[model samples]
Target: MAFRPLGRRAYGSIPHLPGSRTGPADRHLSPALARTLTQRARDARDHVVVLEKLDGSCVAAARVGDSLLALGREGQLAAHSANEARRLWATWVARHAERFLAVLRPGERVVGEWLALAHGTRYALPHEPFVAFDLMRDEARSPWREVTERLGNAGFVLPGLVHEGAPLAVEAVMERLGGAGFHGALDPVEGAVWRLERRDAQGVRVELLAKYVRPDKVDGSLLPENSGRPAHWNWRPEAPPPPPEMS
Candidate 1:
């Protein structure tokens, strides 16, 4: 259940992002994806859904057989992770295991942000700390509409919805979000994720996923390593739980 990295944005680049280079191989958007984001999608069935990108640790709850396991970015058992943030994330996952198990099917995973520790932006989160953005099976992602309906129905707080329907410019999307985002971010949002979807007789196809990170946004500004200060926490569990049992 190793996480697949979200493709880089076709637009602006974050200073710290390795893939934000101008090389040909670093072009994150495919031809179809580029077309869809700039102008109307070629097919009538195609549409775009953009979600506000959060500054937090990426985590997932994967269904392994009958049990749900909390995983870090590289698919390591998060409960055993050397990183404190991931360990805390595992505890949070355990406290809310039933919610993940209720929504995930066999071999499926709910990938999202773990905001217990702030990265660049600190949050006074209005909802749960874990905010799911994708319902995935291996490298394949579920359609945006399905992801929203399914995860939303199961009490998952997803990233803020910036826009839906026709292709929109980054400036336009930012204007729509105003200054702060939906999840109660204290500072300006990092950026937005763009998911392109198309429906046909075969069902919904998740064409491509891209993101736009603000050029001026500093990476890990709130983190202890970056700031040379104490760690900044967005949320914390009441008590640290025992290490989770793993298969």
Candidate 2:
């Protein structure tokens, strides 16, 4: 069965910029607009919240009508009990999740990483599973503080909060991360997502976000430089010439 749709795009994605992309598959856009977006991000580097990009399968627990269903990216099922996370949420966190369900307004959902045995063990976890660095309230994201507080109240493991209150170079932030993973080990963290909160003097609000895929780990699975389109097909930036200026 289907559940609520996810966020339109990740932070710093080409569409996050001022202009726009034709579609997810092609993702064609003007180079000048792309550069402008990057420039704006650079200018707003003073205030940002960075969270460790957990390297695991994406999983979610959404309120599907009367049932709370666990899902993978693209609404894929977790292979019955075969999926470690399915069990983790369907059974382990099942009871605790009720507290969350009590408040959820039906269409809302929570998404997080499902660190199971499938992806190499960086945490050396003893038992069941883990879900952190989540997306709560359907497509809407809860701030770092609210996420932590809510998860803590529900007995879920807290995700890492590497940097806060500044916009810094991806390299600098990666250096600080230095092979850190969920349990604080000197291993690959994949990279980090910068969640910038911007507020104007007139009380207007905006947010600039981006995902910086680690240079060392440029798997198409998660790339800051690349992304999939509407058809969920991944695409790479090639050496083709640009379309004539948008006049």
For lDDT, the strongest prediction is 1
TM-score of 1: 0.85
The per-residue C-alpha lDDT of model 2 at residue 177 equals 78
Candidate 2 local distance difference test against the native: 0.50
Q: What C-alpha RMSD separates each model from the true structure?
A: 5.4, 12.6
Listed in order, each prediction's TM-score against the native is 0.85, 0.61
Tens-place lDDT per residue, model 2, 1-247, is: 4332433222112232222212344243344433333333445433567767765556666665666665555664443444433444444335556755754457656666665423422445432345556545545566566666766566666556667764455566668778755454335766666666554564312254555555455333322234442212111113312332333
Model 2 poorest ten-residue lDDT run: 229-238
Indicate which candidate wins on TM-score: 1
Question: Tens digit of lDDT per residue, candidate 1, span 69-154?
Answer: 88776667787866778988887888788888889898888888989998989889998889998888877889988888999998
Computed on alpha carbons, the lDDT of every model, listed in order, comes to 0.77, 0.50
